[model samples]
Target: MTHIRKAVFPVAGLGTRFLPATKSVPKELLPLVDRPLIQYAVDEARAAGIEEFIFVSAPGKTALEDYFCAHAALERQLADKGKTDLIERLAPTRMPEAALTIIRQDMPRGLGHAVSLARRLVGDEPFAVLLPDDVIRAPKAALAQMVQAHARTGGHMVATMQVPRAQVSAYGILDCDEDAARGRLLRARGLVEKPRPECAPSTQAVIGRYILMPDIFDRLERQGPGAGGEIQLTDAINADVETVGVTGYAFDGERFDCGSIQGFVEATLAFALDRPELAAGLRARIDRLAGNDRFAA
Candidate 1:
């Protein structure tokens, strides 16, 4: 099996959900504690043996590229101050600078269109698509799990999780053949993008991680808008699954939907508690706030 060396991150949309905070800053650069949201996704891809990084970005996103680039002046300043420890932290992200590339989406066409734009860059090779908004914390990185599954299955793989029945319509719902047995992989029958609650086949929603074959570009090119006026990635994936088949990896991970405000707060809290350096201070602050609110009440 060929090792999947590239990963694409579609980050061009205007973060209307985040409003003023994202007005000047891209949402991917938002902090999940000390690291930006994009860094978590990058770390996962790196863990999965992805050597090339392709970021589909737009204006005001130079900072995103810069985040992964070496800061010569900053490194020198840290070194001169005898701050070798601080400099070490920035070293890894700077290595193999050529491994990174940025492409512009230019408009908010849709997820499928954003991915289609990468076809020329990913010609004839399998690639991973990781949505930074889905900040997954797991024993095994979600994309890595999908990559391993794809090697065996040799088809498209999408990371999935069971959502509440009522919440199914809010996600890209999957229709699976029940006769299919369960394992590390699954064969998807069809896919629906934001289907109505009554119309959705199963609550097994597509969580933002995918390992796609290059053939998806052909599907996306002709895929039209199903729900909104913009093309949907689910439609293209679903179209391909009819013949290519899709494996739903019920990924072993605590999935955080950082695409929304509540989800972002939840991810921040979960990630912070796991950190040895930040946990104690954050715990104390939380305890003090709870006590103060109780006293006032």
Candidate 2:
């Protein structure tokens, strides 16, 4: 069993969608509720037993790097004030001093390019790739589930979700043999990046989570700029389809596309409702807002 001790987080993209707000702050640091978007991804990866966290970052993403580092002053302040609960909550954000590696992606090439940046750090092992933009809520972390699937199947594993056919073009669509067991795992035949609806292989879309073998670096190295004239990760994965075998695990979860405005709002509300302390209050406020005549338009 190849132990997946490392996980790569590609956070190099300039978030044009969030615009003005993302202008100064790294979009990964943007809060879904109280926690930053990247924190959720990190938590999921941590739960999956990942030991070393590798962040592929861009020039302007200093805050994203700082997020995982300890804030000594703040920790001291909380400790001195007897805020044990607050300090305990901060434990997840702190990594063992040597466990984090931040690599720079100098250009905005694409997701594949960003992932390739981590090749040296992840050499010769199966590792996971998590896109912080997609925040998933589930009983078990989605990547944790995918890791277990990879342990059993010994191949490339990607987290998948069934999106509506109309929305197929927005994601990397998987071409796969349907599982007779009707379980989460699907044997992938191929993958396409943002294909038109009529040309789509299936309505099953690949989400942000992926557990890949090290040889994927070889495919990504030879890959050319695709789709939007940027190297597409889907293309690289497809390149290895025949040789390594790719599997899509339909992860049990609800994914929130925090990279988009609507999805960010949805994730915020969904997480808020899950908190028992805030559920009733948030529900009352939501009901009041819905009943407001001003919002009816």
Best by lDDT: 2
* lDDT score of residue 242 within candidate 1: 69
Off by over 4 Å in 2: 179-182
State TM-scores per candidate.
0.94, 0.96
Error of 1 at 257 (Å): 1.4
TM-score of 2: 0.96
Count of backbone clashes, every candidate in sequence: 0, 0
Clashing pairs in 2: none
Q: Compared with the true structure, what per-residue lDDT tens digits does model 2 show for residues 1-297?
A: 337899999988888999999899898988877899989999999889999999999886888767888999999999999999999888888889789999998988888899998999998999999999999999998888888878888778888899988999998999976655247888888998788999998888998999999989999989889978988888888888889889889989899998899999999999999999999999999899899998865
* lDDT of the candidates, in the order given: 0.86, 0.89
lDDT of the structure predicted as candidate 1: 0.86
lDDT of candidate 1 over 148-190, digit per residue (tens): 8788887788889988888987888778854574775667888
lDDT of 1 at 37: 90
Candidate 1 deviant stretches above 4 angstroms: 177-179, 292-297
